[model samples]
Target chain A: MSEFARLEEKLAKLRQRERIAGEGRKLRGKGGDALLAALVAEIDETILPRRLSLVTPQGPVHLAVANRRLQALLAPVPGSLPEGLADHALPDIEDPKLAELGQSLKTLLAEAENIPVTARRLDRAFGSDIGVPAVQLPRIWTVAQPTAAKPDDILSGFLADLGDAALAWLRIEGEEVTLQGGEEAAVAALSEQAAIFLDSYFGKFDAAYREPSLACGTVIAPADGSANAVFFVEIGEFSAIIHAPAAQMPSIASDWQRRVAE
Target chain B: MDITAELDAMRVDVQGCALVAYTDLSSQLVLSTSAAANPVQEEMNALSQAAHLALDGAIAEGAAVSWGGETPAELAFLMTGAEVRLFLRSPANSSEALIAVCAPDVDLERAVSEARATLARIGGQG
Candidate 1:
């Protein structure tokens, strides 16, 4: 009832809440791992058996092909999984399509598992919404506004915009683009947009090299999102954009300029 | 002491020095010296810039992303191809960097050592 006692009581309540939040995060991770394990176990125990039964001891050509395709599709998921029913405390893969996951198991698993990790990372870093659909829509639009600057500059700017939108980082080198950090949906959106933009921009130019003169890559950086993403683009003998995180880009830019200036 | 002289000295000391350049992190060529002839020189210029940018991007990812909160170190990207070997080095605490195109069979260790030494000499002169 005294002032100090009341303050102590409030502090105890805050500590309790903190402990709960920490446990909640752990539960989310445990829940995800359990579900993934179950899926893997189901595939190994149930699906594998049924599919194997479809194959004769001598291996039928048609069934073998189907089995091989299924394996390939599910390759990204771990081949081995523990057996057990997941705790229903968190949501399970409720889609009836999970029964048809043979067609798109990877997408479903990524949606269920990776989203939580990505959302947590994005939430801590940029406060971006990770409540995206199981699969975010790919970008599809032509580059309408033409620029007088070289194609490399135009491409670099476009990628930078995508990075900004997603709260990610970009690095462009020659034809290769590296994008790191940000949520999965943001990175996917940027990749889709980059392809569309490059195709349109390069369509106007004559062959600069015998080989395709540009390439791009994206990488989602690990925890905390400091570096985030990178976008690299090569414009043949004309230009290249290696858009790194802010801290490094200036140094990289200056170093590159000095090298060429010599 | 200047970049031009340093590159000239590097060419003599480092065997198979086909091209030497100073570029920004974005792979923008600021200055260049090359043994490559007209058309080839032009092509190499573009390719080298692209290579530098790619290397820089990769380094940035490690520094900024993979190891969060840990400052990324300056990197030297060595790319060995069939015809030639490319060496890219960005000095610590400095924005400008030096990239050298050496012969495929060139001794990379020696080339890189000479490059750093030359850069040091340039810095001292400045």
Candidate 2:
């Protein structure tokens, strides 16, 4: 094949791989013991009235599964865990379903453990660290060149195209409610927006999952941390935006990494 | 916090991340590093500067160049057949960056993100 043809083929393969990644995201979204889905479900469960609670002198101490999962997630590194929350919250699992769930949780935790190793391996194969940064490449004229569009440009255009259909935002000032624009209006929303934007921009190649959703808006909770929430609006199978309080940012970032691991 | 300790925290999450070095942008001197015996400090800084300069040029041209490319310019490939190296620009200072050298199959995205996180923690701009 000609050099141009070879480059075209490589670009096509990359686009195809990106499409496959989108499909994989949908699969994970459907059901998996992977950290994000499980954590989200657990957090959602926490918001609901308790089905299981243990009565104590203090009060009816509700079972916090999210806390347990967090504990389990950090179990491998107990020393790193903050004090007061180090001890295991539950005694043990007796029920078979609960036991199986515990095993699944272990599996997810193991995957989290492998994140660093997997990242290193992928970096080597990708050799993103070894070559001249593409930004520095001499502009070579090509008969079949990939478009020079940056990922952000593509995302901005995509968000712009949404027009009135753009996602709406909610601003929560302390306990007060306010309306703001959606993910597009988020201050310092670049990295968060980039995630969904990349998924949608690439999803165009895989028409099966090409709809995009922007963040609904910020849902502010009182500083007490009782009613805080993270909202996700799925534009389609491919793109979605998550809105959460600033305090939850680290956990959310961890969840994103877990999804990437999956 | 010491740069080595910060890199260690990040290195634990990435398996093939062999070395993490912080270089002074102007002097091209390695301020701190995770490797026991880092021999290629000068080369890494030189290549990293080239990559960083290129990225800045792209940004100047309004080419929205985030670090998510199939082949980011920040990566260095040694023609002498050495391990792959990645250079991450500090978000705090344009001149300084955190360099990571890894095996060929390392997870580029997550590793880079972890390094970026560490950089952010150490008050470096990445």
Candidate 3:
């Protein structure tokens, strides 16, 4: 059966209880220890609202099931969950449905960030040691193919480690978020070329954007698959280039899709 | 390769695809298209133009024509939480490209690889 179908069957069985899928509002239900357990078992972290709270004899019991192994979101409250007939806040489930919740992904695009910029390839290299100044632009690309050296391990396991070291100190002033570093200006300056590319190829996208959601740096295949590139997304307000192991893209992509739905 | 055959196969080849088009970027027009749902003409034109600029425009001038370094300049693909667009520019005719639309959950690597292969053969008249 389709994943959605399975989830549907599980939810249907619990229809006896109120299902509050959206928020604040409470959805009620009646008696089904096995049903609740079954529903949690099938839908892993791939789907959100994966956690549902049951109003029980003890109080509101939160059920957080992930990776098919019940984690802290575990419930039953040790005899607190009296013989079923409890309320569940199932907001956004009826209106959007589990299938409708996100763009529905089948890729490994784990995390995506929409950093402010006109957009330029800022290939920074950080020294393994802390307090070391990270090189902002590592490679020197020529106007024509002059055999310039660009790192082939582009961004692989690198972004995850960058937070270990800090190139620019962060401070907050009133409502303004500030990064203390001249590198910010350099990255912005590099956007001039990127701006040109954005205007020429990927047209600006106007959406319900919280921040800049236009522009993407591109990379074509037939290479070693190590070089990083960006995709100018045509949907929603998000604009980011995803970097992750190709194999894990689907689950990660689905996670991103869920966020968009939110 | 049969363009229609290739486009039709995308239904099974790539999950969640809505439409596929073979576009002549020189004119930013669609030569042919295949999809379960028909999008408006304006959408197709926009996609065509986007494909043209991505591969043939000024940004392409860098890295001496191929997509910089060892990367091939045959394909450009992006997926969003909203829509997924994949463009493959034919090496035979720089202006020719394939535009594909799919849902966010699609296997993007497969989409690009399949589209790139089709564009490559489009010139050979396979």
Question: Best DockQ goes to which candidate?
Answer: 3
**Best-first order by lDDT:** 3, 2, 1
At residue A206, candidate 2 shows an lDDT of 32
Per-candidate interface DockQ score: 0.03, 0.01, 0.18
Deviation (Å) of A142 in candidate 3 = 58
CA deviation > 4 Å runs, candidate 2: A1-262, B57-82, B124-126
Give the poorly placed runs of model 1, Cα more than 4 Å off: A1-262, B36-48, B62-69, B78-80, B83-87, B90-93
Error of 3 at B63 (Å): 9.5
Please provide, for model 2 over A1-262, each residue's C-alpha lDDT reduced to its tens digit, 9 standing for 90 to 100.
1312332343344344533223211111222234323233222222111122212122222223321121111122233223332223323232233333334433434434211100000111211122111221112111122233332333334334333332332222111222234544442343233333333333332331222111111111112222222322221111233334423423332332222221
Each model's C-alpha lDDT? 0.35, 0.35, 0.38
DockQ of model 3 vs. true complex: 0.18
Tens digits of per-residue lDDT for model 1, A1-262: 1312332343334333322111110101123234333223222211110121111122211111111011211112232211111111111233332333323322233334311210000111111121111111111111112112433454455444443333443343322333344555544444443343333223312211222111212221222224433333332222222324433432332233222221
The sequence of per-residue lDDT tens digits that candidate 2 reaches over residues B1-126 is 577799777666777667777776556567777764565755555544533432332211111212122222232211101233555667666567677766544655566568768878888423
Q: Which model is ahead, 1 or 3, in terms of TM-score?
A: 3
Interface RMSD of 3: 6.2
Candidate whose TM-score is highest: 3
Candidate 2 displacement at residue A178 in angstroms: 52
TM-score of each: 0.31, 0.28, 0.41
